[model samples]
Target: MQRIHWFSTLLLGFAAASSAQQAAQPAPAEAAPLSAPVGTDPVVTQPAAAVEAVTNVVDRAADAAEPAAPAEAAEAPGQAPVQAVVPGTPAAATAAVAGSTAPREGKIPALDSRLFPRYDSLQPKVAFWTKVFGQYSENQSAIHSSTYPNKVFEVLDFRADAMRLDKLALARLKNDEETRAKARYNRLLEEVDRLRDSPQQLNEEQRRVWQLYADVPGERRFRDAVGTLRAQRGLKERTALALETSGKYMPAMESIFRSYGLPVQLTRLPLVESSFNVEAYSKVGAAGLWQFMPSSAKIYMRLNEVVDDRRDPWTSTDAAARHLRDDYNALGAWPLALTAYNHGRGGIARGLQKVNGNTLPDLIARYDAKSFGFASQNFYAEFLAASDVEREWKTHFGEQLQRNAPLRYDTVETKHYVPYETLRRLCDADDEVFRKLNPAYRPEVIEGKLYVPPGHVIRIPAGHASAFNVGYAKLGSSERFDSQRSFFLLHKVAKGESLGKIAKQYGTSVASIKSASGLKNDSVRIGQLLKVPPREERRPGPVIVAVGESKPSLTRAETAAVEAERREQARPAARSKPKAPRTHKVRSGQTLSSIAKQYKVSVNSLRDANGIDGSHLAVGQKLRIPAS
Candidate 1:
């Protein structure tokens, strides 16, 4: 299912490329080269090594191949096929012989440096910035905090009749020039803010004309333009924040990417996905830096009431890298593969088929599927913008901004369900520090309602490994920290109830109840309290019927007759009794059970009259007692 891009290229060649071009219109800019040589760039060279390594393996496999002879004619005892080994043998010769002797097969070629060009082109740069501005503006217009500061100015150079700026290159400036630049930046920010607010006080002519197009769906024409302008103005601020955040996680994330034999630049993707915010949550329930939805996350990460690994940056990075690797193997192009991150693989594949476009640039311009909305259409562009920003932050912000410190932690696998207080004491960390180190634990778990799940790899602060180990050993293996491990509920014994009958009703063994309650024998008295296990785990067995009665089987007619007789008998008894007082006062530790007993009524009847559902009661509270 995961087809490499090179296989399509090696076999299909021009046909595949041409078919893709025919499906969609040519992109606005010239297409990147399909097979550019890996130059000196480390980023380019790093991936090339992995691709070349795979190619070497494929070549060796071909050279070692031998043709199968007729089974009866070629019979020999324990004879091995001839192993091909030649000093300085060319891969092509080995492949040619293998092709003649057997079916043709080779490793699909790796993504050439041609597809991932550093966008120095004007057309693509503008497009990338436009998308970046669009997404930033959209988020700003919403009711959430943005990583990019709202007040900042973006400086663009318009020389040679073209818009250009080496955002990643530091501007060589004299002391006086730095002073002038700061002054100019302040002025631009003020002007942008003034222009943004001026549109709100629209003239009559403009207001009427704008209203004409107001009813259109998904169109916020004027407001969107203003938001884009604001985004452009604040680009430097947001880019700086992204760069700072990247400092903390990029090293580890890049290591993970390299481990999967993926491009290291993929690590910058979180800037577009969540601005590197570990706590970022989307409207559609996607969470964390990668913005993974619950459905996709469950496939790769552990997600449940106890722990949500999606919030764990370290773990989620590994999952995200693996997912991207699979996508690349399937689509064979970084552009389409990246698009699949925002949209979906199946959708992108269908869009390509519909347009017959093999190239990502072509698909970008021509693919017009309704499902491929603005976000999907511009995802790759946004990623490019974020990458550019991340790479060039030092050039723009200079030494004024500080990089965030890298995160350091030690992992400890808890042996048993540990309570928050116990773990906190063991780690010698305050609540804030503990929670910061362990974001995967839900709020209830941290608040002590639930225990930290057993075998969970907890992240403790670095340099405290020995202390944690000692504390854990000292704590030993104990269930006292877990109060609800078995989840028992209190059961009050009734006058006619026996231990065996109670056990059968509650679906628990009599021995379980005896152990939980520390009972010496099966003896139980009226009003005696006992601990009972949950009902869902109850054993399926014959219930205690009556003194000498066996379970009865009744026909529909007979059942109906018995129900009618019972209702008739109850109706006369209810009519015979007088109504009780309207309200009854509560007493200390006296629950609905005791109150019901005092009035000779069912707890359900008492609750319905008092308009309460739970068993909890307070002293001196008035309740409406219904007549029996």
Candidate 2:
């Protein structure tokens, strides 16, 4: 059966080939194959000849089975007829058709209808399975949302897995960062605490108090107070030196404070005011140990060219104590009174009112109190702190600290102008000692009946009281002449007048005129004020030769030179000169002066010449005289 089938297949394929060939050769008009049928199984064509032959044979067999149409007679010239192939035959013929039915130039690969078909042909089973898989993926993504997209628990699971990978290292890094931050914070806190708590850091007393009470806890107050005390005691040597030189008048200061019933501790106020420098001057022109501004000093303390009582420790303290007492009376508080001392009562009052009520802390926090700079708000606190420390150190240390010695002096009133030099010489007191006792005298000169004000307790050295009284009496006497009186006058130099001419006119030397007027170039203006000596015997004319010899005529320059030489020689020599004694007799009808004149003797010589008083002389008396 296999052999017969093969042979028959060959014979049928040959017959179908013949028919197709014959059809290709101008076949009758109705003999062409039809288009492939719709809904029939489409055949894939192969270009291989053997496959084509088999397909053709199959198509012929199918064709044979179908009935052939009757041959049509020749039609009219323009008419055409259609020929139909059996249903199976067209498919067989399509199977046999050519090497590739796909377009040789432009054709798309056909889609597998089984995998993704047209909408109408889609299988419900496959679509359902695909949807289920997609949903599963979405759920998985949602689970990992922290690390991935579109899953519920995926993110949480991812984070957990990552955390588990390096959990110990992450914890250590976090701990280290926290520890470092904490250390930095603690270091800053320590610095702030030191600044807030260390009173030893404060150099000024005014600063110490503020630092002490600035947020200091009550429990730590005693310790802080003690520390401040030790610090203040350590400062004693410096304070002592300062006070010793400038605070000699402190006794009087204490008396003044006592009179006002104010605390005597204020005597040490100058320690803060000016470190006890009497001539201390502030940048704003506040002067003296009390640091009084010019206006305030003028108002409260005595100020003048002759005397600035502000520089006098006793007087300024008295004034300050009085002012402070008055302020206290007005304010009814010490801290407010001290604040007034700095910012004035009105300013402090306004500041107090600004606080919403009269409260010190509130006023400090709110009001713009700029009396002593930004640091001034704490000024009173500094004073209180300083006072506290001073008291502590004094009580605990006792005499181990060198206490200030009390000042001692006597007071004397004079209703005359007394030169300071005269007082110093007569009282046999040193300049410092005198100034210490009489601090109210600015120039140290008492002019025209000064009462010696309260603080001026004149210091009379031992056994000098009598001498000072005699000098004081002499000061009152009008008979006494000023050796400097002539130099005191003002003289105008003429155009042609040399310093020599002017000095001679006033009985003084050119050098002296130049010196007194501070003339550097010996040049004088026409109206320049020049000092000259007064006419007072012309320095005895140089004792020209001896008294017995004839006076020689001298040129102006020679005379001046001789006079200068004599003046220079008149100063006592380092060694003493031997003395010679001579005798003289009073002549009858000849005055002792006439006899002394013949010998060129002085009136003092004549007294010793005849043992005769210059007031009374006897005739015929012999006297001894010293010869120059």
Candidate 3:
């Protein structure tokens, strides 16, 4: 439920960018925030395999070699520590108890003023974000001007269950809120416009709004700020929880960054991204601790049928370090690199070229491109404030707060491609404990179908390395496959075959079939090859142990077929109501207008069908076709 709310908040942040400027342009007919969807970064073709034999992981845990410190905060062994120096704040003057880890030669500069400059002019903006992290809760939002973030007009308190309400009730509530917001906006516009002319006849509330711009040196200040009003929902409560959650991964995460020669402060970014929700998945397919979209994630980490590395904190941290290292080398500054992380390097480069500015502050003040809106602009500021919130933890969340303990596990490389059952037997692991330690493995791998790749790093409970080494050495070759089996088998779609029949026959869900094939619906054309999951089979067991070796593998048996009603349940119930119409996949050269004309529906209906407000469409994007 919290993840859902965060996803919605991400969308609202996107919509808030353009909402402030609607007074200057024709607004969407609905003008609802959901109209603007936060799409994924540019899609890249995923390679076949992102990793080879070796992993960055082989370090064994020392168990008790490290203790808590102010600088490194190295709470556990095998956890490397480095502290980020806030720009303009001297290392000694800020805070530091003592350091155990020696400084490496030519360490990357902290988010310094030279690379990540904090102009006095942008303090209000930074302070606004500080409040976002420290003051406001998810149910509250502050209405302010996008042009001048400090000119906050009001803070809105929404019902706790506002987002959790049913669609119809939620819509009605949103409509009512929109009406109230419009009325408030009109009254503010009246007062601000009056200030533009009279400059003296201000009511108490109006004067407060007027005084917000007191530092402005122009006569047109009031008039210029008129159309820039926006509202930003707060994540204060979530961020506070994230501060505690961050401790579990922070020690190892900081070490990963230090290994990459990057600043440890980058660990705080997840506070802004997922709020430390490891299982978080955005609607656009981004996932995990770092929220790496599959398109970009595949380039740096392995994301195959059996495992998505993004879901694993340690593996994803390694990928994020490599990713950030590349971004910094390309962009040359943490500010730009961080911005580029959100808006994409191409987008940031374009913003720089369009604004003719090298600094993030300048780009924020000048970049008017619609794509570089609220989310992109606030990325850096949020990071700085997040880092501050962590540094000044006692001042905000209280000194008595208890953080989560450091994650303690030792990763060992597998000798060959193996099954989940075989690996579990090797470690003598409980299913739940094994899952917790190795979160990267997918459901297929967990269910004993997908083969765990060779050289894959599997985490075992601390102090179990010697036991695993002995057990693996006794296992026969027949018990462990020489190579991993593909997760799926190709099946050509035959005439009269429905996805439901094929999925039922294979003991898999229709959703799995569609996802594996990238199908928009159950419909498939004849002769099209689909990646259908192989039927369930008995798992291989240990053939040799305790002075015995090289025994033959046990024969598997045919699985019983599922009941008809059970198979029908795998697909949505067709008897409940009529099925939704087939969706249209946006091909090249297609627009809402063209698609609407092709389907004989209004363009507005097309937008409504897809829950998208704007006309922007990506190639191969899917859209539901509303009943005409």
Candidate 4:
């Protein structure tokens, strides 16, 4: 597979935990260590023939940038390493992509700067990101301050003059990068000390560090910056690729936003979200073009064992539009609203209340909540940078940018629970093609074990609509099912029930059963609980410390998880409860009214008792009952 890069970059503010490549998996040990007065290396890099630009990395778009702890998050696994791009110099003059050598002569897509005006205070951050998104390539690492992201002090080119690398080579390179970075960190502090009193005695690199923090008085902030130094892999390759990829889905997205009376340019967000990787799923359970966490996505899109609309571009786009509109309405500011898309609206609202300010700059400069870490701070800057890169990608890559044509497909509704293979063959659709267009279908549905849910919308290949309609029209009672196949959603252990026996009962492998629930061993006890396993497609790859003073969260949050529900749920019973209430997992075809009636309680009481605000329920979703 030509591992696409766009899917990774569209995940905004997430250091692309979504389907992005390893930070040009640094071939570190290949290069010689820096000599005296060393702050950065600006060697020429970014050779297309050498760079694995499209290797899939993860974009934790929905996973807000958590406060970075001392340790950094690792990349998804199974990717062959490539050199990181070095900054301060252009890449080899070969076009970034295979396109016309001549730059496209046309007016660039003009974003409404008023809506996202680059604040003077935030311009440095935006410029730094421009370099990350357009100037630097995947193989390049800009060692800069976490607090002062624009104060880039070093450019570590892990390429070590190599284009590609094996695992051994990658390990060596990573080791070399760590050694050099650690050495340089101390050397920077030492150099600043040597030049502390000798303001007049400064080398090119030393002078560069001093000038980077010219905004702050004295050299204390310089030392502080060195202490906070981190390396962020550039996304030039990824964002450029995403710009090309955006063509396939941008038209529909822009139309969707416009339908919601939003700025059409907001459609460029996927460049920041998962680099527009519609299939990008985080280590946390955030998924889809919108990168909705399962807890949050369940409210807008169908997310369950059978379907995850977050993975479906069409459905996810509509959901994102609605979500963004709602965010904007609540925050009353585009910058804060966009930031809230990643940082929870509740968190942002709390930040606003704390600062008593509502501006993006205010939040960026002042918000100090535990969760308002790197991603939250730089989210607006990233959005602006991505938007800029996407708008004028030709300026950055010239003829290398060859965009895909807009996706053309007609959608049809399934009349019944149709077998995936039956409809697939009827429409003459290739299985892979079918899968991409209907990404929301869970593996069971795609494998034909489970049928397409009734009334579900399926996108048809450009020319296969008529064939699908004909096939669907002829579906007999035996051909079209009205219900999903039985799913072993949960299993309770009986005495002497082992994982082997449980796997057999579910027709699944024991390893998978263990993987789904993170089970360590096969020991089973009476009343033990377990669920079927989820496939682990992406393992943590090479570790790269990306931007933001705060940490990038690898976990998904309930951003849409309203606090009202939590408070309501937390309200203790007026009377000291005698016993805890029993819980129930919602099953298909069941509603609150039915459940409440069965429990002999009012629907309103059920809503007040638990945090549930909507009538919707997913199978296996547990709800706590109130004690009478």
Candidate 5:
């Protein structure tokens, strides 16, 4: 009976608790009303009214139960409170129902609030999706974050696991991109390295040695030089001729370089400087095989119109070698010396100072030296490349070159204008050979009686000393002639002065002045100088007239009549004279003037007769005819 009583008591309690829960929850009908269409008017809602009625009944019961439970707890004393029977009951249930049935508290919880924040702030809120995706996702969002939200699904961090996943999916593509980038970077580095290492590619000695050949304009220049060593056909004939003429001085140059312990390759420098033409003159007034400008030539070799020692290959080469040696000593390096050659020693020294004792490469990188232009900067490389090509070409084409005998010569001192042809004849040398060897001579004459200048040296062909001496004995002592006396007097017409004044100044008649200067209608330019040929000396006496005297007088009318008569006479003379013959052989030591004098003619007549194109003449040459 007691067990039944206890079971009945438990059943009663369970029934009461079930009844309370049933009351707290909305009825199915009332819950249906709460699910009315979203846009429906809330004020007219019968569903919300039913829900409120149920809620009020449940709240009233809970309030009455709360007071009664407290009163019972006070009556029972130590017993547990009735409200404590279900802790967190109403609040927990409300939260769960709100979470499930209502629009989710945070839509798309991982991405919603933080990434698309409700307000603008200095620090962005941590987006819900960004946190779910972790650090890399947050970084991605940070990268693209702005006030507007668009295409949110496309956000994937470059450093994220998603990127790694893609890489794994396309392994070949990732590898190819990486390889291409690395290769490009490495190629750039290699190019930089090549430029950096260029300064070291050649030693100072090698640089100096190669500079002699490298500074030339083209490979053909050096090839032409070497071609002279072996007789070859083509453009090398002139080069060979130069070599034959100038090579005689190479040994002397070599000796100078060796004296200074410099490389023998320096002997080739003159080949480029002046094409072995001792008389070569540059536009800038640099002369000789070394092509030294007037100022520089004076510093090294002696120069004067009478005796330009700079034209003496031996002397000039020696001087160049000495200058180079001095530069090398000061700089203590061959490369610097070579640079000094292009840009003077002082310039190189300043450049070196600017670089603070660095190597050539370092100096190039650190300093902005303008000397390294297209030609000058690559000058050394060109020399090296050219030398290599020339050496190989010579080795292969050696047989084609003509083998001219080595030049051998003796020096003679000359003070007077000995015609070059005369020297050639005396020395038993071909006129061509003599002219080639003695290029500094203008008019082919060495002026003044001096043993060549103090340093002036003349070259004679081999085995001609005794013949030259015998010829010299036959030639008479040198005579001096006044070149100024050869000039006819030119009288300057003063301002406001007439031809009469000029004639008076020149001791000639006005008619003579007008005739000589080609004055038309007796009008002349002011300050005009009329040329007056020297006349025979006259003795003071009264004029005498012979029978039939009509030689013409100095009066204007008489002068006009005489001129008219002369014009009439000249007309017949012009018609009667046959055209002068043309063509002539170039005689030894015969200039245009001398030839004209020999033929009792004018220089222009000789020029026209022979069709001579210029003042220069090659001895023994035959010329074309001119209709004089």
Candidate 6:
């Protein structure tokens, strides 16, 4: 009976095969399957050509299942897709999804998405930049503005480059009236130049307030420049936002300041420095909310390869407290102390001596030092303006502004050097949370160049101490989260190289390189091997040295050549057998009489240079004069 049943099944299979062969037909485009899985489980009745088509589809899908090409190679310009074959397995599918997210190749990689949420806390509040814009409004120096009539407004900056157009101007520039905007910009510059040359009339009150101009060389020019400046009324939208955002930090900053016996009002200093911008950096090397220069920060903060305390709001506020206290002690007045904060103690001291005055108003009016430029002169006034705005924000901005909640965090001291990643994981917080709490750590530490130094305290989310300890203990005894224990590259100095160049190359800084390599000075030599800090992503381009310090690495031979060239330049020009009459160039604010006195030559000789019969001497006009 079993043999009869098996024979009956075999005959049924043969009958089905014959039926499939008889129904064989060409495969059509519309008949293609949406997906193909390798390894047939069920047999279907189809033509031989259709079976081959199905096999080809399955082969292509299996090839696609291979891990995607590296993100950089796949995204390369004019790149073509590559088909590869791999064994049909779950692991291959898992890898294909994972490979799609490879780190992008670019000068600046996309910041971790987790960082986006924390940006508001780290970045300058919109209100802060708005306040900056308002401070410069109603002046003759505006570049352009969308909110104002004719889309133009004035800005004032001691540093020429700081007088940039605000967001409103930027938006207006992107409009169809860009040509008109440019014309208005040029007109503003011309107006400022014209005002600088034109004489200005000042009221009695204005003259008293601007008494510092009495002894200035170009009093008329300076007076006109000052007269054109107008204070803005009411708070701008961004300034209002700044006030609201600053509320979050006010509690912490005020607490820190009060702890150090500082006036709570001092907490508002960041309003002028950066509008409480944690990442604010200046061309002159000032940084953070407090705007501390490297030299000054070194006194009250830990500024080194592993950390820059200036960027940490809490740490920097403490440092600022110490500095402000020291300045008050030396100057015996808040006005002088504040001025010294901007102008340096030495500069303020020199100004006091030159003017023979102790009061800020008197010194400001009488002191005529060259270094007492516009920025130093107006630092206190700007502070006063910022303070007033903070005090009267409600009247100016109403209730439209929104404030951030106060920051809350707890601190933990590391028993040993710990990696940021390890500590972040131990605290069970995201990267942004970890970074926002500890902004003092240098990029090297964040990028994995170094570890949290031994005995250093790092901030973590509130109420995570127990979890932190548990996670830390779970790790092996030998897991000493140190950079040296991890992979790092050692670079050998070749020919001419500089700390700046090497730092840029490795996406670090001169200070970081110095701290890592234990360098004592800016100088480096050929064949000297230095440890290059590890970076998660290195910018691909030429080294970007700060402006005014673009000196490249120089070899021994090049240094010698530079020295020889300097010597040649320093050497006096070869004199003719008979010395020709020296010439004097008439400069602004200079008279013929002044030129004659300077060169110890007669005014008649200067007049005879180009037959100048009148006392007038145009600026830049070359005049022949007798040798001293």
The numbered model that scores best in TM-score is: 4
The superposed Cα distance between candidate 1 and the true structure at residue 512, in angstroms, equals 20
**Rank list by lDDT:** 4, 3, 1, 6, 2, 5
Q: Taking the tens digit of each residue's C-alpha lDDT, what string does model 2 give over 1-628?
A: 0011122222222243343333123212222121121222221111122110011011111111111111221111110111111111332222222211111111212222232122211122112111112122111111111100111111101223334547566445434433443343234334444555564664443232333234335544423332111000013333434423332344345445555666655555565555566666655555676666665554454464346667665556655775676666666666566656655666666667766755455566577544323223433543433333333333323334432333333333333334556566667777666665456675424432222321122444333455666676665444222111112457877789888778766545675555445567677778777765323221111111111112212223334445666777797767767766667666668765566677776544444323332345567666666574
Residues 1-628 of candidate 1: C-alpha lDDT, one tens digit per residue: 1111222222222232343333223232322211112121111111111110011011122222111111122111111111111111123223322322111121111223355543222233323353343333211211100111111222222222112324223222222233454444344334433443465765543433233223323433333323222112223345455555554555456555655677767877787676666776765667787877765665555565556777867667776876676667778888778878777766777778988888666676678665675556556656665554443434445545544434444445555567877877776777766776677777767777667644355555555557777777777546323212344568999989999999976656686677667687899999999977433211011111111111212222233445665677687554456555777889888888778888777565565455453568889999777676
Encode model 6's per-residue lDDT on 1-628: one tens digit a residue.
0011112222322233343332222222232111112322111111121100011011122111111111121110110111111112234222322222111110111212221111222111222223443443222122222211111232222222225756466434333233443454344434444544432654332332233223224534333432232222222433444455454455456545555566666676676666666776765667787877776765565666677888877667766776777777777777777778877776677678878888677765688665664456555555544654554444455544444444445455555556778888887887776777777887778887677654455566655666676776676655553213333457888777888888876666665455456677788899888766444321111111111111212223223445666788799999769877677677899987788889876554444344444578789988777555
Q: What does candidate 4's lDDT look like per residue over 93-210, in tens digits?
A: 1111112111121233445667766666666577667778888866666666667676555666655434577757765765577457746765766687668778688876566555
What TM-scores do the predictions have?
A: 0.46, 0.37, 0.59, 0.64, 0.36, 0.48
| Local distance difference test scores for all models | 0.49, 0.40, 0.58, 0.58, 0.38, 0.49
The RMSD of every model to the true structure, in order and in angstroms, is 24.0, 60.1, 22.3, 17.3, 51.4, 34.4
Per-structure clash totals for the candidates: 5, 19, 0, 46, 17, 6
Please give the ranking of all candidate structures by TM-score, highest first, separated by commas: 4, 3, 6, 1, 2, 5
Query: Which of candidates 2 and 4 reaches a greater lDDT?
Result: 4
In lDDT terms, how accurate is model 6? 0.49
Question: On a 0 to 1 TM-score scale, where does candidate 2 land against the true structure?
Answer: 0.37
